[model samples]
Target: MARPIWSGILSFGLVSVPVSLYAATEDHTVHFRQIQRGTSDRVRNLRVNERTGKEVAFGDIVKGFETAEGEYVVVEPEELDQISPGRSKTIEISGFVDLDQVEPIFFDKTYYLGPKGKEYAKVYTLLQKALEQSNRAGIALFSMRGKEYLTAVRADRGILTAHTMHFADEVRDPHREIGNLPESGTTVSDRELTMAEQLIDMLAVDWNPDDYKDTFEEKVHELIAAKQAGQEFEAPSAAPRPSNVIDLMDVLSRSLESAGRPAGADADAGGGSEAGAEDEGAGKPRKRASAGRKKAPAEDLSELTKAELYRRASELDIPHRSTMTRDELQAALEQAAVPARHLRAAS
Candidate 1:
C-alpha cells in the first residue's frame, strides 16, 4: 500500500475537515543505472570541487545562485528554511470557478484527498457532492515540503481529487512560438465534404480507455519472456514511413473509405461516418474535428444516412468528391485543407 504524502485539514469556507493526501498514480517505466561499458561495473556519481579537483562532502555542499559570469553566491540550508513558508497544515480554499474554465494545460499532478478520520468523513463527502452539483472546482493554495503550491480540488465520484497547477507565467503563448499561421480562406466543395462525413461515421465509437494498450511495453515484456525461455524471437516489424498527402480532398475521401463507410453516405456531414477516420499513421489531431468546419448532424455514425453524411461534410469544409470511388472519396476527405491546432500525440 502507498503511504500518505501529506496530512492536513481541508478548509472549505467555515468548515474544517481533517484529510490526508496520497499520490493518485505511479509510473512503472524501467530505468537503467550508469555503468562501465565493457566491464559492466556500476558507476557512482560523486560531487567534486572544480578548482581543487577533490571530492566534496554533503555537509560542505550548499545551494548557490549565479548572479554573474563565473560567480556564484552560496546560501546555507538554514537560510533557505528561514525564507520558506513554515508548515501550517491547512489547505485553504480561496474560491470556486466553473471546472470547464480551467484549462487542461494548467494541471500538473493529481492526488487523492481522503478524510483523516471518521469524524471528518461526512463533511469530506459533502464537499465532494457539493462541488459536483455546482460543476465547479475549488481553487486553493497549500504549503507542502516547504514549497507553496496552487491547487485545484474537485469531486470525482465520491472522492475529492486535488491537482497541482502551473502558475500563469509558466504557460507559453502558442501563437508566439508557432510563428506564421494559415488563414481559413481555403475553399472546399460540397461533394468532398459529404464523403468525409460518411468516413467519420464508419470510424465512430465510444471512448473507452480499456481498448487502448501500451504496445511498446507489451512487446518488451514478450521479448523478455522469449529470452527467459531460451527461444529465439524476431524483432518487431518496423512501421511504414508517413506518406506525404498531396491532395487534401482525395485524402479525406480515401480516409472515409478506409473507415468502412459508404463513399457517398451523408455527403453534407463531410466525407465519412460519425467516428471520423483515425489513421494510426496520420496522427489524431483535435483540430480535424473541434476546430474544423463543423460536426455532422448525427452524434453517431450508426444514426446517419448517406444524404446526411454528404451534408455534414459540406458543413465541415472538406472537399474533392467528383470522379472518385468510395475508397478514393474517403482518402480525399481525410486530406482536406484545415488550420493547425495544438493537440496531444500518443507515442
Candidate 2:
C-alpha cells in the first residue's frame, strides 16, 4: 500500500472525519543526469557567487521580487509562512459547490483521501456517497511544502480525491495574453460548417483511455534499448502535412473520404468561393463571406498583447516602449499606424 503524505481531519459542517491524503498520480517519464561532453565526468550544479567566485550557503539566499529591471525586494521564508493560509495538519472543507460550476482549468494536482483508520471508515464512506449522489465537490484548503493550496475534493471510485486549484488571478485573460485570435464576428460558409460537423459526427467515439498509448515514450525506450545493444533504431513514418487556406477544403474532404464518408453535393457546395482563399498569409487583406462588408479602418490595437505592441513599436521606431504600460503601448501602436493608413487612403 502507498504511504500517506498527510493525515488530517476533513471538516464537514459540524462533523469531522479523520482522513489521510496520498498522491493520486505518478510520473513515468525517463530522467537523466548531466554529464560533461566528450567525457564520462558527471556534471553537478552548486550555489556559487558570480561576483566573489565563492560558494554560498543555502541559508544565505533570500527570495527576490523584481519590480523593475535589475531590481528586487528581498523577502524571507518566515515572512511568507506568516502570511500563508491554512494549517499544515488539517485539510478543512470550507464549503460545497456544484462540480460542473468549477472550470476544468482551475483544477491541478490530484491526491487520494482515505480514512485514517478503519474506525473512521463509516463517516468517510457517508461523505463519499453524499458527494457522489449530490454531484458536488467540497472546496478545501491545506498547507503543504510551506504553501497553502486551494483544493476541490470529489468522490472517486469509493474514495475521496482532492485536486489543487489555481486562483482566479492565476488564470490568465486570453485577450491580454494571446494574439491573432479570430474575432467573434468571423464568418464561415454554411456548406463548410456542415461538412466539418459531418466529419466530426463520422469520427466521434466513446473516450476509452485504454485505447491510447504514448507512442513517443515507447519509441524513446526503443531508442535507449537499441543503442545499448549497439544497433540502429528504425525511424517512424513521416507525419501528415499541415493544412493551409488553399488545401483546407480538399484536406477536409479527403479526411471524410478516409473515414468512409464520400464528399457529396452538400460537401462540394460553395467549394470555389473567394472567402476560402482570403488571408493566405499575414499582411494580406482578409475577405468575408459577404463581399459588401468593408474592412475595419485599422487593426484592433487592444486585441494585441503588450509584447506584440512593443515589437510593433520597435518596428516603427517609436520611443520609450520599454517603460510603457499596456494601455500606453496600445495608444502608441495606434498613433504609429496612422501614416500608413493615410498613405493607403491617398493611393
Candidate 3:
C-alpha cells in the first residue's frame, strides 16, 4: 500500500468524515541528470546571493513578494501557514452541483481520497453513493502545502475521488489570447461536410486506454539501449503534411476508402461501415480490399507518409506490419501491389 500524502476531515453540514488522500497518477517519463558536455563531470545548480556571490543555505532562504514600488516583502513559510484558509486539515463542502456543469478545462490534478479507517467507512460509503446516484460533485475548499485549492470530490468506481480545480480567473479567454483562430463565417460545401463526417464515422473508435502506450517513451528506452551497445538507430519518419484545401473532398473520400469503406457510398445515406468495430477484435489481421481491383502505381508509394504507408499495409493484410519501420512498410506495400499490376499486364 502507498503512504497517504494527506490526512484530513471532510465536513458537510455538521457531518465529518476522516479521509486520506493518495496520488492517483505516476510519472513514467525518462529523466536525466545534468552533465558537462564531452566529459563525465557532473553539472549542478547552487543557490547563491547575486550581490555577495556566496552560496546560500536552504534554511536561510525566505520567500519574497515584489511590490509595484520596487521593494520586496520577505515572508516566512510559517507565516503563510498561519494565514491559510483551512489550516491544512479540514475540507468543507459548500454544496453539490451537477458534475457535467464543470468544464474539463477547470479540472487539474486528481487524488484518490479514501476513508482514514474502517470506523469512518459508513459515512464515506454513504457520501459516495449519494454523489454516484445524483451524478454530482461536492464543491469544497481546502488548504495544503501552504496554498488554498478549490476542489471537486465525486464517486469514482465505488470510491471517493477528488480533482483540484483551477479558479475562473486562471483560465484564459482563447478569443482574446489567440490570433489565428478561424472566423465564425468560415464555410465548407455541404458535400464536403457530409464526406468529412462520413470519414470520421468510419474511423471512430472505442475509448480504451489499455489499447495505447506512450510510443515516444518506448523510443527513448530503445535509444538508451542502442547507445549503451554503441549501435546506430534509425531516424524517425517525417510527420504527415496537411491536406490541400482544394482536394479536401478527395482526401476525405480516400481516407474512407482506406478504412475499408467504398469511395462511392451514397453521401446522403450516412455512408460508413462497421470497420472500426472490426479493429476492436484485436490480434487478428484486418480484411484486405478486393484483390481483383487494380491498385495505385508503385512509384507513388514513396510520396506517402509513414501513416499512409501503414494504412496501405493494413489494407493489404501484410504480416508483421506493426513491427515494421516506415521504409519497410513502404516496401511491403509496394510488394503487395505487384500481383495486381501483373494481373493487369497479363490480361
Question: Which one is best on TM-score?
Answer: 3
| lDDT scores in order | 0.69, 0.74, 0.79
Per residue, candidate 3 scores C-alpha lDDT tens digits across 105-146 of: 999999999999999999999999999999999999888887
Candidate 2 segments exceeding 4 Å error: 49-86, 263-347
Reference-based TM-score, model 3:
0.76
Ranking by TM-score: 3, 2, 1
In the range 1-347, model 2's lDDT, one tens digit per residue, is 99998877788788888888899888878777799999989998999987898999998998899999889999887777567434576777889999999999999899999988899989989999999999999998778766888989999888899999998989998898889888999887766775686567545545778989888889999999999999999999999767786776777777666654423322334432323332322434333334233323378878865555555554443544444666786787776667667869899
lDDT of 1: 0.69
- Candidate closer to the true structure by lDDT (higher is better), 1 or 2: 2
TM-score of predicted structure 2: 0.69
RMSD of model 2, in Å? Answer: 20.6
Q: Model 1, 215-269: lDDT tens per residue?
A: 8777777788899899987898898656454676667766765544344433443
C-alpha TM-scores of all predictions: 0.68, 0.69, 0.76
After superposition, the stretches of candidate 1 with alpha carbons farther than 4 Å from their true spots are: 57-60, 75-88, 184-197, 223-245, 263-347
